[model samples]
Target: MRIAVTSASGKLGASIIKHLIKKIGNQNIVGIARTPEKANHLGVEIRQGDYNNRHDFDKALQGIDAVLLVSGMDDPQKRIQQHRNVIAAAEQNGVKKIVYTSIVGNDSETAFSPVVKSNRQTEKDVQEYGMQWVIGRNGIYIEPDLEYIENYVKEGGIRNCAGDGKCAYTSREELGYAYAQMLLDEGNNGQIYNLVGEAISQAELAALINQVYHTNLTYEAVSVEVYEKERKEALGDFLGTIIAGIYEGINIGANDVHSDFAKAAGRAHKTPLEMVQEIKAQE
Candidate 1:
């Protein structure tokens, strides 16, 4: 089957394409990106696939048997229609199967709700489409924390509004493997899987970081308002509020959900310790 992955220039999209190449070979994979040149290094047939442009997808998805729709990063309201453009184009092009990468979040509370709601709408659209479909609600990615280790070290600890709530974190690599399986395996059709790893509290994450990086960093829980203010000061108004909202959801236990990683990927999700160890090995 010929599989097309949208947003192929992105990290998550690229990771999924990498795994797909291993499973099906580059000849059978298509990389769809808004800037096709940016994805040339992926060594697949690159097509221009701007989510806002139905004409682009009309040509891009032509002759493709299946598609992987990576959720868009535009404003939540705008992205709903953008996603539809791709879905409609896929149908027009006679694509047979579609897989969407959704997210796990509190739909009622938090600044992140709009994004979640948008994805939910797209999920509904894909399910109602005249084709086979599978959806995966991804957990919070742990890479940001690992990437921010330098800043955390300088700050002497990690400070957030998560309190004692646990977060089910997964990595792009893990999500990539699962998405590849979802695209190729018909058994996952019509299934919505919560792709998450082991849940752990902020304090536990700090301890793991300490063990892996050999640092004496601590986790301090702060008030939501205070954390929001600090994040705003550091990251500006828009992104800061969104980041704060994610932590607020965590504080409310929205991120601690049952994981279907094993069912989705046909294997167990990697442990947090193993993830950190892999990073250390890479360093």
Candidate 2:
């Protein structure tokens, strides 16, 4: 099948393309990026497909049998409009299928409630189109913890307002592999796959990190305001707001989900502990 991956220069998009190239030859793949030059190394047909540009999508999606619509990264309303444009462009271009990268628990209101609501709308549009489609609800990525780790380690603990809440964290690579399989395999049309790894609590995660780093680590439960303040102090306004919302999401039990990601990937998903060990070794 001739396939195209949108946002090809991104981490998840790049990972998806890397694994997809292994299954389908490079000639059959189209790398759609806002800046095509960065994606040239993928050795696939490059197209300028800006999420904000309908004309770009219309041209880029032509001749593609299946397209992986990676979700937009910014303001909720604009992101949804961009997604709608892609859906429209795909339909107009005679694209047969769409595999969307959505978020876990997207049907509920959470820290990213607006984005979740928009994603739900996009999912409705895709399903209502009566076209071949697949939805991959990706789990929270563990990579962001790398930024917060130094603080946690220095303080001998991590502070959060999540109480006993847990997150089903997975790596971008694992989610990418799952998407690749969904794109390459034919029988999974009209399905929703929750691409999550394991639900692990903050205390459990801290202990695992301690085991790997040889440092005494723990979770220091704090008030929401304190957590927000600390995160704002560390990550600045933009990322701080996002990370604070994540804690709120954790508190609201948003990321607490379960799924057969291992079965979908045809192997065990990487654990957070394993990621900690890998990070520790690098340091």
Candidate 3:
């Protein structure tokens, strides 16, 4: 049974590929990346793949029995189109199973509405293709918070507009392992798994970080305007808006769904506390 992973050079993709290699051997897996050369180190067959190019994916997915299609990093309309191209190519190439890494939002009118709409459309397209499929709506990754550790330390707290809202933050690395398991397992066709951890609030997160780092950091609930201002001043408007939107999305319960992250892995999923500890250990 041959399998392929798109965007195999990315952090999550590479982690998935590694876990797959351990389970299925490198020879049975194909790592598809925009530049195949960048994925050569993965020790699997490297193929040039692009979500925007049907021909590229058609050629890359050749002889593959199953595939993991990581959603493209683009605006909603463009991303959905790219996903369509990939689905078309996958179907055209006769691939049997597909696992998509989607975000956690089924409603189109949510705070992070655009991505939800695109993912919903993509899910519709995948289902319309009449192939065995699994749509894994992944939770907001907790790993990204590590990037703000220094800032939190400097500011003596975490600032966001997410007032009392909780999020089910997940670890990207473990999520990849679960993906590999799902790909290897049989009879999960047409299932939609909400991959998430326990719902945790920002105040709890701040307290945990303080406990771990031995600092007196607090969680401050600011207005959207103030949060946006601080982020824009620190990281420019584009990234600032994106970052603040994550908190805004959380406030609206975008990532608060009950999920299959633990069931998919057939084990207890890591908690936010464990995830933070793991991050600290790595650092």
Q: What lDDT, from 0 to 1, does candidate 2 have?
A: 0.81
Off by over 4 Å in 1: none
lDDT of 3 by residue, 1-283 (tens): 9999999999889989999989989989999999888888998899998787888987987898999999888777799889988888889989999989888863653335776788888988888998898888888888766777887888778889988989988887778888998798775667888888899999988887887777788888988778888888989876777677777878877778897876576667787888889888988
Q: Which stretches of candidate 3 lie over 4 Å from their true place?
A: 109-111, 232-238
**Per-residue lDDT over 153-233 for candidate 1, one digit per residue giving the tens place of the 0 to 100 score:** 999899999999999999998999999999999999999999999999999999999999998999999999999999999
Each prediction's TM-score versus the true structure: 0.99, 0.90, 0.94
lDDT (tens digit, per residue) of candidate 2 on 1-283 = 7999999999899889989988877889998999999988878899998898999999998899999999989777788789988888998899999999988753454445666777777888778775699888888887766556777787778778877888888877788889998887777788887788778888887887678766677887887778778778988866666666777777778888878676566677778787666655655
Give the root-mean-square deviation of each candidate in angstroms: 0.8, 2.3, 1.7
Q: Residue 240 lDDT in model 3? A: 76
Q: What local distance difference test score does each model get?
A: 0.95, 0.81, 0.84
Better of 1 and 2 by lDDT: 1
Instruction: List candidate 2 stretches off by more than 4 Å.
Output: 106-109, 232-239, 275-283
